[model samples]
Structures are given as structure tokens and as C-alpha cells.
Target: MSEAQDDDVQEFAASLTRMKERTDRSYGQLARRLNMNTSTLHRYCAGDAVPLDFAPVERFAALCGATPQERLELHRLWILAVAARQRSRTAAAEATGTAGTPPEPAGEPVQDPVSPEPAGEPALDPVSPEPPHRPWFRRRRFLVSAAVATALLATLGSLSALPDDDRRPGASDSVEAADPPRATRPGTPRPKSTKSPSPSPKTSSSPSAGASKKSSPKPGERTEEPSKGPGQQRPPAGVPLTWSADSHVWQAGCGHDYVIARSPRQVPPPPAPQDAETWAGTQNAVHGRQTLVEVSVQGRTSTAVVLEALRVRVVGRSAPGRGSSYAMDNGCGGALTPRYFDVDLDKDRPIARPADGNDSGVTIPAMRLPYRVSAEDPEVLLIDARTKGCDCSWYLELDWSSQGRTGTVRIDDHGRPFRTTGIDGLPRYSYDTSARKWVPYS
Candidate 1:
């Protein structure tokens, strides 16, 4: 080997080590940015292989925010590495390559790593088809964890990949990793600081209100309870939606109009009063972004179509002048999805009206929940029509008994699919990654 070639090997090794240590990035995050994996990253870092693709490396550089000079040098080195590998493989094949040899019979065991380099340089091992695994233990687990922690943010199912632009292998992602990420509704009052440091409310009442004279605060004073802003409560990733049944019993909307509640598998006609509207439908599609499902039911005279969109949004945080902008359209009868509430609540019925609320409330189910609404999906109303309510975990009780004994639909919020007391009576689905689908959570 020439002196220059040997120098190149050492230089490449040093550069790789620098890249690994210089940035504390995880294989997952780097993969998302570069669209590659840990094993590939391991090889690249170890100078085991020059990439056939430049994307992952480029992504890493981008994450590192490499300087112009550094970027240029990286490409230059990458090209040299590739060229060397090609030459070595070519010479080895010409010398002792079994270029077209057939495989041995079934009983044969594969040999150890075969050198593809004609010289003494080590041969490049082909990547095994299986993913790389750590033993029951691994070194650098913490570093790998930090990388993964920084990236691989859990997102909703109809995945809109985070723009590669927002990602970095560094600690600062620009977007505040708030407990409950604070987002403003469109058209709502903007704070002087859009990304304000979370505020602590100033207690106004006397500190000793309703207390004995000695314990009582002055006439203008008040006692205060510990209060944290909405941002203080963020649901951790992968945490199941804790079931919280309302102490208030669910009352069907409108005194006389009883909505039929049934399971997805029963075929019996609901025991309906002659005056009740018997709703039925096929579990066609659930456009959760719009928080609505499209249902088509068959009856004696004709088929009934109903667009059921779940209503969840942040209260008080909705933009002062926004609503309906993010609701999904069911696209029925030549109508669009979220095609406006079938019956407008704002105009007719009594949706919850916050006495202190400045704007009118939009129509939704009697049970409203605070969900990552509009700020997450602009086309959905959760962003525009905001409201404040108890953080009640909810699952729409869908009765599919009209279809079959086995009709069911899994409700997936935040990519973790869970089977709620599935029938009107029991929600039982849990996400089992091992099973790769929703199993009974109960």
C-alpha cells in the first residue's frame, strides 16, 4: 500500500470518530432526517462502507448545521472513499472472484467474511437482511437514547412527517418542548410574545378568604391554590388515554331525540320508538383529522347517510375569530366533509356557553374534550373553534350491531391504537407493537 493511501485510511477514521462524537445524535433521529438506519449509520461512522446514497450523510450534516467548508470537505472525502472501494472490489473479482458460481446445496454452512479487496485490506461485508440487535445489554445505550429522545416524536396516524427542516441532531429544536405544548388558535389574540415563557397566574383574591380572623387575609387579600398554566400538563408519549368517566351522567341531546347507541357487530334493529330516527351505517372510513366517520345505513325505504365527526378542541385558546376551519368534510350527497354540523349548534341548540367567554361556542357533542385540534390540523376545526373543558378521555360509543356480529373499528389517537370498551358497554383495545395492531387494552 502507498503511504498516501494509508494516510487516507487514518484520516477517514478520524473524521468518522469526530462526526460521531461531535454531534450526539441517535440512529433513529438521524435516520428520519437522512431516511436511513442505525446499522447503516454504524458502518458509516466506522468507515466500514462509503454510502451508496448521500441522503443520510447529508441529513447528518444538515442536523449539525455544518459550515460551507465542512460540507464541501465531506463530499470530497465521500467521493474518494467510494472510488477506492470500487477499485478494490474490481481487482479482487478479477483475481479470485467466483463471479458466477452457484450456491452449495442446502446442507452447506456459509463461510466467514470473504475479502472483496485484492490487497490485504479487509473486505466489505454485505449487510445482513436482519436489523442489527444489541444483546440484553449495550454500550452507548445512553447516547443512542438521547438521539432517539430528541427525534422520533410521536405523531398522529394520518402522518404528516415533520418537515426535515425542523429536525436537528442537537438539543435545541427551536419549538419549545412544553409539557402541554402551547398553541394559539388562528385569529385568536396574539400575545406580545407568541412563544411566551409559560406564565403563572397572579392570585387576586385575599389569601385568607373565608378563614378565621387570625388566619384571614386583609379585606383585599385572598388565599391561593397552586396553579400552573395549561402548558404544565402535557401527556407523555405512549401514555394511554386514561379513562375518565364523567360524574355527570351522559344525557342524550334534545329531550325527545334519542340517538341509538349500539355495537359494531349486532344485526338486530334497535328497539326504537316509532318517532325515533333509526340510524344505521357501514363502517366505511374514519377521517379522524376531521374527528368524523362516514356511515351509510340501509332501512326499509332508503339508505341513510350520516357524517359523524368527533368534536375536540382546546377551550379559551381558540383564536378569537376562528371556528370550523379545521373540521373535516364527510363528502356526502355531494356535500363536503365536516360539511358544517348537520344541525348548527351555534344557531339552534344549547352547546356549553362559558359565561366569561367573549365569543360564541360552536356545536359539538354534549361531552367535549380538549384534544390537539386545529393547531395540529389546519383543515380541522379543533384549531379554529376552541373551548375549555375538563380533560376527559373519550371514545365515541359506536354501535355497529346493524352490520354483523363481528363489525368493529379501532379508535387510534396519537398513533397508539386502543380498543376502548368497544361495544357501547366495553372498550378493550391496547396497542401491542409486538402484535402490530390494537389488542384488548382492558
Candidate 2:
């Protein structure tokens, strides 16, 4: 066989294996469903040999529940495999200096033998067919490769141009698979995973956006006093504002428990805790704290709880360098934008710039803690940042302890939380004298 034929066959087999995995079925089950021998299915999956028929390839893809586009790609690969086989056969025939008659395709019925002409009528000689031109066939193969390259480039460009809001929960990723939440390195903030935005709670005219619903205190449990921090103030007196009826899941690293906080209005069943942590972490921030919130375990639901307050505090700053820089020519050829920076206030350290073209201003990691809020002291900052972007969004998280008690808070905002072009310490909400309104992150 020619080298090109070998490569195509291998690629086809690899794609088949990937499709089979997406079906979440065992190989034995697949073999039964496809009506093929176990060993034969194994060979196809193992890239030992390419199938000679396209019908079985299509059937296998259908049985594996491949999407229409996936099935189309599989069919394309099958065609390449067939072309590779033809080239290999043609090469072999040329090397042997003999015309190779095309073999009957697999799964076809054999024809009956023709009756001999009655008694010796003069037999006519059969006409020979012309051999295929080798050079022309080689050029056709080159053209096929060029077409494949163009298709790949188009696919990548479309993906790169997708808007941030187009990314939704349960939506297929670039690879069309649901990836587990990524774990962040200790001292580095956690990466944000945005789900479809549900309705947010009605923000009170008060400065704090989210309000925590009151939970009944445990029998004989001692409540701690509120701690005074820099620029801290007393919570307002009134009916504590209610949050929207929604549940939220925060993904931290391994050894850390999964948290699903629900508002007081809804009583959704809690999901089972994972047997193991989804990612690795140091568990540094939640240390020295006690578990105050009742989390959902495998088979039971917990009482609903709400967030008291979510705050943002500036902790550190950074200047964009080669590793942190973004495009100067973002379709606008005026003055170059300044270098970007990201700060993790909780860790009191600066983070590296994003490696993509999203022009993110800041990323606040999610935090889960063994903390509860006091009615009087509601100021607990989850995450804060100053960032740059025209059409982007970011997440903020803060976990804190006041007077030996602890609590958690989070925030989500469209666009950067801070102006990208402003001085480092300024929050995105700072007033802009030039624009006559709050500065835009863009």
C-alpha cells in the first residue's frame, strides 16, 4: 500500500474511536448493534485495516448517535480511505508492470457463469481497456489535499470570531464535548465558567446588590462578633432584600467540596457531591474556618440559603508585558492601547494577561467558604478587578471572615469591571470627566 493510503486509513479509524466514545457505549454493545464480529470491530477501531464498504461506515456512525455534522465528517474520511485504497492498488499494479482490473466491491453478489456459445461459432476477441494515467491521478490527489486544508482554515476562523455571549451552558465546546471545570493553580484565581444567565435579584437602591436570607441558628450555637475592616460600614436597617430563586454551583479544585447555594424562594434538590475532587488545590483560603453552610450530599437536599453581600476590593496591580499584551490594532489604527493587567485581590497578587483576543480586563475566581454573614456587618468582597474590553464580561468572588465568623460572595458584570485605559488602582465604576458618565471598560 502507498504511504498516503496508510495515513488516511489510520485517521479514519481514529475518528471512529472518538465517535464511539461519545456514544458512551461499550465496544461489545457497538459490535452487537452494528452486527459485526467483535474482532472485526476491534480491527476497525484499532486502525488495522480500512473498511471496503461505505454503508457499514454510515450505519456505525448512526448507531453511535453522531450529529449530522459529525456523520458528514465521518463520511468524508471514509471517502478519503476509499481513495487511498485505490491509489495503493494502482501503485502496486504499476510496480508489477501489469494492468490491475478493479475488484468487485465488498458485499456484492456473485454473478452466474455465462453459458458457452453453442457449438464452435467463431469466438470474437474481447477489447482491452486503456490504463489510467498515473501523473493525472497524482495531481487529483494533490487537489483533494488542498481542499481539505482550506476547509480546516475556514472552520478555525469561524470559531475565533464567536462573541462572548454566544457561549452558553450545555453548549458544545470547540471540540463538541462537555469539559470538566478547569482547576486554577493555588495563589492564582480560579477560572470562571459562565452558565446561561438566569434572572438576577432586584437590586435595592442600597449599595450592596445581593441580600442574604436569614437562616435559623443551630441549637446552642454561639455567634461571633463582627470584625471592623478598612472602610467598613454598618448594614442598613430594613427587611433584608431577597435574592432570585436560583441555584449556583461554584467549581474549586480537588479536596474541596462542591457548593450549590440556593435562594430562599426555591427548594431545588441538591446534587450529589462528587466522590473525588474535580481538580487540585491547596485549600489555603478556607483554612481555619468552620463549615457554616449545610451543603447538599449525594441523596438529600439542604435548606435554601442566600448571599448577604458581595463586595470588590482592589488588592494589587500589574503592567502588560510581552506575555500580557493584547493586539494594538483592534481594527482601530489610532494610539496603541496600554499593556493589560489582572489582579487577584484575595491572594494579594497580580495575574497574567489572557492569552486570547477576548480583551478581558479582569477575572475574579469563585470562592466557597465556611462562613455566614451577620445582619449588621454585610460587607464581604468576593472579587474585584480593573480590566479592558469593548464587548466582554467578567466574574468576581470574595470569601471573608469577620469577628471569627466567615461568609462567601460573588458578582457577575458585563464588560470589564475597570477601565482598561485608566490608572491601575481605579475601579471600572470610576467617573469619567470626558465621557460625562462612569468610565467604560472598553
Candidate 3:
């Protein structure tokens, strides 16, 4: 191999290794995110292999949050490596003085490492396809965020490909071990990080004020106490909607409200009628204006749509200088955290103000969950809204547009898909919080 080509390979490997370390993700973490074997990723960083396609490389770089300048440099290095590889193959063909039969493709079972190459020579190997086992809920949160970021990147044209089949091996790839990996380097095997399912709040048949502060019982173990009277315990405020043990989905009786969270946690009891004054005042604060459109979520831009339904339901507007956001109110009465909310454009009633004090105070059998009003697809608005309620999680309102008509369907705030058969015999359906009825789709 020419000295110049060798140098290019080494430089590219070094740059990749450096950026990977910056991401603070273990090789396994990255492999899971990239949907490939850890060894393959290790090879890429070790300069043992170069992907024939730029798709995975581009995704890896973006997942690591590569800057434009860095991306350009990486692209340049990739080109050089490709040239170097081509030159090596040509030289080998010339040396043999015969066009040798092509080698079998990658994804074969791992054989013993071939003889080590001379120092400074690239160690080439056929790329393999074997994805390590991924446990349930393992790296789930991170995967969600990564998926969102990848989607955003694809949307922005930064990514060239996003195959639904993540495990597909690159058609053409050649590996050359540029150098022995250093002990402190990223490619070396490391222990996978342990992740436990997120904890759920304590579940009880009744809602209590101190539920959030109480330690939750272990899953499958519940403590039963004497049922408290209505005054002693908070009456179920929101209407009972849907509950699925398998899906961990809980919808309000008022409908159009849902929250996604860890399984078996305490579902916040319905909001008390007396406490209605607290959130009821929100009706006076804003309604009917599309002022808060064009908001940001996890750094990606989105537009908040103010539906005509909301405008007709309430007389209000967004607070000046406030961002449009939504989230589940767990009744904790604390600052709201940012969570994803999917609002449907075709089914949900637009954000509107409640009626007078009685109407506002009137308990709606709703979860009062949060939802993002806008999404990348105009038909489906994915909102990144916030809330001040501590007990609340987040909710999603599904948006669909057809025949020039748009409506929003209410999904659980967690954005989980509803099951066909709920606890009762009735088929699961989305609630129209505005119309105070079930949303039936043809």
C-alpha cells in the first residue's frame, strides 16, 4: 500500500475514535443504536473495516452530534479510504497477474482472526452481520431519543438512508486492521450498562393527596387498606375511560386524555372538584390564537396549530413570550418536564378555554394529560409541551387529515397505541374531550 493511502486510513480511524469517545456511549450502546453487531462498529472505529455505503456512517456521525465541519472532514476521509482500498485490490490483482475469483460476501460466522498483518499494514476482514441480543425496555429511553433525532436528521436531509430493517448488512465492505487497538481506546470490549424499567407510582383503587410522596410497593405486591370515604379520600375526579393491563394504557372517562409511563405505577386519582380552581384559571390565560406556532422540541423545530374548534370553544390567546407546550399533570403541582405529545389533527377538539368558574370547576372525567399540538407531518402534529403538574405524565392527540378535513384523535399521553379490546367488551376508542363523546372513525 502507498504511504499516503495508509496515512489516510489511520487519520480516518483516529477521527472516528475521538468522536465516538465524545459521545460517552459504550460500543454496545452504539451498536444497539446503529442496529449492528458491536464487533462491526468496533472494526469501523479500529479502522479494521470501511463501510461500502455511507448510510450507516452518516447515521453514526449524526448520532454522535457531528458538526457540519466535522461531517465534511469525515466525508473527505471516507473518500480517501475508499480510494486506498480500491488501490490495494488493484495491486493484489496485478501481483497475481490473474483476475482472481471474487470472495464470498460478509455475514459468515466469525472464524478465528487471520494472521496479523505486518506493522503499519491494514488488517482486512469480511464484514459480518450478527446483532447482539437486546433485552426488553433495555436502552429504550435512549433509543427513543435517538430515533427522534435520526428522524429529524432524515427530515433535514442530513441522513441519506433510514431503513426499516436496521439489521441489513452493507452489501460491500472491506476491513483492514490499521493498527492494534490501544488499551484505553473505545473499540476494546466493555461491560454493557445495566438499565431497569422506570419506576411506577403506587397504584390504589382510590386517589389520595400524598400518593406522590409515598413509596410505591414492589410490582405485583399491593397493600390493601380500609376503603376511605369520599371526604376522606379524593373522589375519582376525571371520568373512567380505558385501562389495559397488557399495554399499561389508562384513558380518562371524559376521553381524549391519556398518559404513557412505566407499568403498574400509581395512576393519579381523578382531580378533585375543589382543586379545579387551580387549573381552571388556565382557561382565562390563553385560547384561540395561533401565536405560539413554530416551537422547538429536543432542538428540532415544529409548528403549533391552533384548530378552529379551540377558537370556537374558548375566547383566549397564548400568553406573550410563552412557549406552547403540553404534558400530563400528575397533580404534583410542580414544574412540568418536557415530554413528547402527539395531537391528532382530524379528531381532537382544538385547545380551547373552559366555560365560567362552574364549568372550569366542573370535574371532567379526563386525565388532563399534556399533548404537543404540532408534528413534522402536517396531518399528524407531534407537540413538545410542558406542564406544572407533578403527578401528570404526558398525553397525545392523534391528528389525521382527509378530503381537506382535519381532526384530532386522543391517544394516551405516553403516545402508546390503544388496544382493540379494552377491559370491557367495548372496542377501544378515542374520546372527543370537546364534544364530550367517543370519536368514531369510518
Candidate 4:
């Protein structure tokens, strides 16, 4: 391989190692979580191998809590590594002169002309209409030879009539019969084989079939009973539920809050919520006090997926970063009625609870878990996560069940954990839209 191509593979491996280190989990543990071999994972992280499919790499990055930007970069590196590996293989094959050679047949090679026919002793002319004039003794010998050949042919015909089981192994006549030729006209149906068809690998080993076999749970293992009737079928190979989350979504009236590492004079006026990510990056800011996330979920098929519950997992916690809190808006008069969930990052066991609407005095009815959604019907959720004591990194686990299978999908700020920091005593400011400048907020 060229040095540049080798470096690409190493670069991909380095990225994987960095992500693995950030997770703080052992290779064995990560392998178990990913349903892969421990040694395979090691080879990937150690630059000894590259995966042909990107699914495993993507899953590994998500498990390591890589940010969206980081994931994108990792994917690009993976592409480069895969391309380089393929090119190297092709070059090796071309150098070996076996790139497109067909494999030689097995077993002993046949003689070129089968012993050159007994020194050509007056060979018979079977196709000739008349034989040359010969002595009486020669004519007599030819007649005897014809009689012997006829008897040999009769014996061979008898052997051919015997059943296949009685025939000797490796007989020259043991070749399989070929199919009859078919017309090549367009739209003509081809003849079907008389042999029985084999079972499809996908149908026999699909996830749904495997899931059905685990109906009886093991000791101490949590299992969801199949909700389908006796005749109902399971969903296909993968999870039917799909969802997307936007962590940059705005809170209805007060706008976004960012804790930026800059003084009032150094910071610029707040940007709109849609542009919050870029703006925060420019200002070296992190989430302040609360982070609002919008999540939309639906089923990929017609089967309904039941959203059982929303669970919170805290990845890490630290003292809030020191910075000034900048509120994107001074004040606004509006309300939103989308399903809302409040998350308290300071709690020992954080959970998502239904919250009421803001600013409109509207008391939203408490919506409990077990919501159903399908391809035609989708559900949107607004999450307002707040921290009062520490800077927190966390993500959500959405539990769902459909068509006799249950699974959990991780929800995050585009592959990374959603971060929210306490801002109780930070210098707070609000943008004066009329003046287009920052002003101190109580």
C-alpha cells in the first residue's frame, strides 16, 4: 500500500480510539453493548482492520457520545479508509496476475490424446462407403474385429441401463443433465426448476423470528409480553420506530439562554434560535440553566409503536462553567401547546415530567406515557431540561414497543449529550431589540 493510503487507515483508527477513551468503557464492555466480537473491536480501534459497513462505526460513535460535527468528521474518515483499503486490495490482485482468472477444475488432469491409439495399426474407416481390396486373411480378421466390437457395445448398453446406485463412482457417464433451452423473447416467463426451493436466509434468521423465540424470559431479565393476538405477525428485521431531535429549538417566550465566556462589551447581540449553534460556537458559549429540545417520532411502517416512557441517563456532571448568561429575547407574549416534559438535571434520579404551558395561563392536562404513533401519525415532544446545581451532560432513552418487539432509542443533541449548566449567580443580560444592544437583566 502507498504511504498516504496507510496513513488514512491509521487516521480512522485514531479517531475510533479517541471516541473509545471518551466513553471510559473497556473494549469487552463496548463489544457486548454493540453485539460484536471483542477482538474485532480491538482490531478496529488498533488500526489493524476497517469495517466494510458503516453501521457498526456509526453505532460506536453514538455510544461514545460524539457530537454531530464529530460524527460527520468520523464518517468522512471512514469513507477515506474504506476506499484506500479497497484500492490496496485491487493493486495486490493486479500484481499477482490473478485479477480475473477462473479457477482450475479439481482432480487429476486428463491425458491429452489418450495414448495415441495403439501405433495406428490399420485403423478402420467407418465413414467410407467401400473398403480397399485386401487378401482373404485380412478380410476374415476385419469380420472378427466387427463382431467383437458389437459384443462390447451390447455389454456397455447393459451397464448404462443399471440404476444410479449400482453405477461405479466417477464414471464418465455420471454427468448431471442440463436444463432444456428456453426462448429468449422479451416478457417470456422462464421455466421453473423441478427441485424444491431452499428457505431464504432473511426469512429464517430475521430479528422478528429471533425475538419471537425469546417469549419466555430468563431469570431476572426484564421482558415485555407480546401484545399481539395469536394470529398477529411480528415486525421485520429492524426497529420500526424513528425519531429526530433538535436541541437548538427555542423556548416559547423567553428565547434561548447561552452562557458565553465573554464580557458584555465583548459579546455580540444574540442570534435567532435557528442560528443558535453557530452563534454559540462563535461566542464560546454553552447552554445556560435550561436547554429546550424538540423531538419528533413516527413509525416506519403501518404498525403502531407504543411510546412507553422517556428515561434520562446522566453521562457526566461537573460544576457549571463560569460565564455570563445571555438571554436571546427580552420578553415575548406567546404560548405553545405541544406536549412538554420538564427535566431536572440536579436530581439523583432524573426523569421527564409533564409540564404546563408558559405565559398563557393555560393548564395543560397531564399526559401520561403509552402514546401511540404510526407512519401517518407522528408525535412531537418539547423537552425543557434545567440544572440548578451543576453543569450536566445527559441524553434521553425512549422506550418503545411494537409488533411483539421492544427496544430503546437514545435521544440526544445530534449524537452528543445535551448539556445544561446552572446559571443562578452568573451575570445575566438581555438583548434590547429596540436598541439592538445588550442590557443587564435582574
RMSD of each: 27.2, 27.0, 26.3, 22.5
Top-TM-score structure, candidate number: 4
Q: Judging by lDDT against the true structure, name the best candidate.
A: 4
Provide TM-scores for the models: 0.23, 0.26, 0.25, 0.47
List ranges where model 3 is wrong by over 4 Å. Answer: 100-442
Each prediction's Cα lDDT score?
A: 0.31, 0.38, 0.38, 0.70
TM-score (C-alpha, index-matched) for candidate 3: 0.25
What's the distance in Å from true for residue 24, model 1?
A: 3.0
Give one digit per residue, the lDDT tens place, for model 1 in 1-442.
2345435544654565576443323343355566565556656766666776666667677666577788778877777776667766776776774576543445323342231223343322346431234221122344467568656654342256555345333332133332343233222321111111112212336646524332222211222233234545321111111111111111121111111232323323222221111121121111111122122112111122121223222111111121111111112131111221221112222132212111124322321222221111111111111112211122222111211111112222322211111122223233344644433333
- The full ranking of all candidates by lDDT, starting with the best, is 4, 2, 3, 1
Worst 10 contiguous positions by lDDT, candidate 4? 193-202
What is the C-alpha lDDT profile of model 3 across 1-442, one tens digit per residue?
7888888788888888888855424565677899987668878888878888888888899988799999999999998987898898799788876685433335432232342333453323336422344222233345567779988977878445655344433332222222232133222332211111111212355466436443322222222223344445332211111111112111221111232221212222223332321232222112111111111111012333323221211112222222221122222331211122323222224342222111224432221223322332112112322222122122223232222223332333122222110011112233344654433321
Sort by TM-score, best first: what order?
A: 4, 2, 3, 1
- Tell me the deviation in Å of residue 339 in model 4: 3.7
Candidate 2: RMSD to truth: 27.0
TM-score of 1: 0.23
Give me the runs in candidate 4 sitting further than 4 Å from their true place: 1-234, 335-338, 358-362, 433-435
For model 4, residues 313-353, the per-residue Cα lDDT tens digits are 88889998898898887766454444579888999889899
